[model samples]
Target: MAATAAVAVACGAPAEEPAPEAPHGYVAGAEETAEVQSRLVVADAAGAVRVLDLATEEVVEAGRVDGVGSVTGDGRHAYLASDDGSVRIVDSGSWTVDHGDHTHYYRAAVREVGSVPGADPVAVHADQAVTALALADGTVALLDRARLDEGAVVELATIPRTPHRGPAVPYEGHVLASVAEPGQQFGSGVAVHDRAGAPVATIDEPCPALEGAAVTRRGVVFGCADGALLVSGSDGAFAGEKIPYPQAVTADERVREFRHRPGSALLTARAGEAGIWALDVTARTWTRHDTGPVAAVNSAGAGTALLTLTADGVLHALDPASGAELAATPLLTAPVAPGVRIEVDTSRAYVNDPAAGVIHEIDYADALRVARTFDLGGTPSRMVETGR
Candidate 1:
């Protein structure tokens, strides 16, 4: 461990004095003014957080938590949800704050900035304004991320605990949460609320069993049994529009789980036993593909292609438009049980071989072959790669 550094940026004003002249400490591997970058955050079964540098493919930092749920990132930091019902904001220590003339690159310890309470951590806005927390009891807490950056955990609103398993999305001053139809297991509607937790509107647009959710540049979308729910607008005037599945695509075998990086316009999900669906956010469309019982997935390219891993340790790249199999790479050396998973972004695809205590990195644009492999020497139960 090293000493920590703190730097905050308040835009829209020129510096009162010229930026401080200083001797540099730990500099980021990439320049702040360069294109955006991200690092991987891995949470092991022993309740420890291990970070692997995306470039080096080596563990760089380690920390501890109660348990790992969803980990959300905003380029500058990561907010991780634990089994203990706490959300700890970990400084990714690799970020850039843009100013007019120059950008400030930063490197800090993998430290906890602040936290809030909820059984699970959900969405983090693209600009890092707020974070949403969800619980199995169907409660959602929207916390202010800007306050967390100021070393505060301010809860903006908490939707009462309902009887459904759903997550919430936060816009400027409003939140959208999925709700189940009365006495039904599927969530066919969404409840909208203001910052004060006051109900604004309830949208019933027929997206049965809403489960998978992703926030895109276009808007926030949720997966449904019949189709997807696309939410547009901002602040108090948010609108929910239903994008129904084409009549050619039936709902009986639709996927309820979608995996994607928050703020990514593209989303990928699994359909039934061996089906894959690529969602295009810009046009609000769904394209079907197959990955043969995919266990876990992370997608990119706005529904262009998908990097997927089946339950049997085989990784496949499929053409999102035509359900064509592009490539396949066997990921594991030894057979393991079901539940191993893969996470992919624009740069690389990370696959965890839990049975071998290893994580494999593949060049997605190349032949889908292993570029690097990490021998962790221990199994990592839950993992999330940060860097878009």
Candidate 2:
């Protein structure tokens, strides 16, 4: 990933240097790569964080945090949210920028960028210019994305706290936020706001009890009480459409969090305890499968099986169309920790076994093959993959 050039000299004459052209999607202090530089950011409950390079198998200490309750990422930076209302940002030093027809990958030094005060951040979303962090307290904090790339946490603006639990996503030069109706106890719908935290427009869809949000190729999806709300548009003019469940669902069976390959249209989430919910954003449909007692669930998007970790600590790949068990492997010990997660990239699926202090890499396409297992030497309570 080094830049090189050859200069020619004739008769001892000094060669005139041509103007340098910046590489496409070039960022200062980062080296652009040819392939995705995938890295896993693993964190323990005590705040020890490590970045495991998927390609080199090298583990780099990304400093640490204090009282880490959960960890999340936005394809680049890992956000470690602590229980004491403080959040720390760790740049995994790897990421991909998708420009529709083309993409770019980058790598740099892994380091802890900075921290912001927000009690138990539930969601962290980013775009080209801003990062919006939605806390459990309903406050949304917006940080400058460019400064974050420079290892700094600069809060440009903040959307005041609301009564909802949904994420305020950073969309095209605006923020897609959750709003609660008067006299309502939970999120009633989504609203659009400018970067300065001022309201611009409210989507008409009444998405009561919104719990989860994800940005996909189709658009941004928010899990609603009755169904999922799909919001799509740009330039401050957006519209919402309701993708209601085909059949009636109880409160316990509703999807709270969604997982999928970054920018993929298909999403997967655990439905209550004994089922899996697959949402096809392109088809605008939801499919339910009776998977017994799931611990975690995710997929590599279209054409991949639904990868689920059951209560028995075994990983199973199920057909997304018919819910048939396609493959299975005992990846973890029985009675896995509650914070265990299944992270699926394009070619591999990863699961952390806290009890055994290892991360399992499964080849889902090859009948649940345990391709490699990296022993972390310590427990990784929570983890997220970057540089997808």
| Model 2 C-alpha lDDT per residue in residues 232-286, reported as the tens digit of each score | 9875689999999888888899988998888899988878965999999999999
Residue pairs in clash, model 1: none
Error of 1 at 228 (Å): 0.7
**How accurate locally is residue 175 in candidate 1, as Cα lDDT from 0 to 100?**
73
Candidate 1 displacement at residue 152 in angstroms: 4.2
Reference-based TM-score of each model: 0.79, 0.93
For candidate 1, what is the TM-score?
A: 0.79
Which stretches of candidate 2 lie above 4 Å from their native place?
1-19, 182-185
Residue 146, model 1, lDDT = 66
* Cα shift from native, residue 252, model 1 (Å): 7.2
lDDT of 2 at 144: 97
| Span of 10 residues, lowest total lDDT, candidate 2 | 1-10
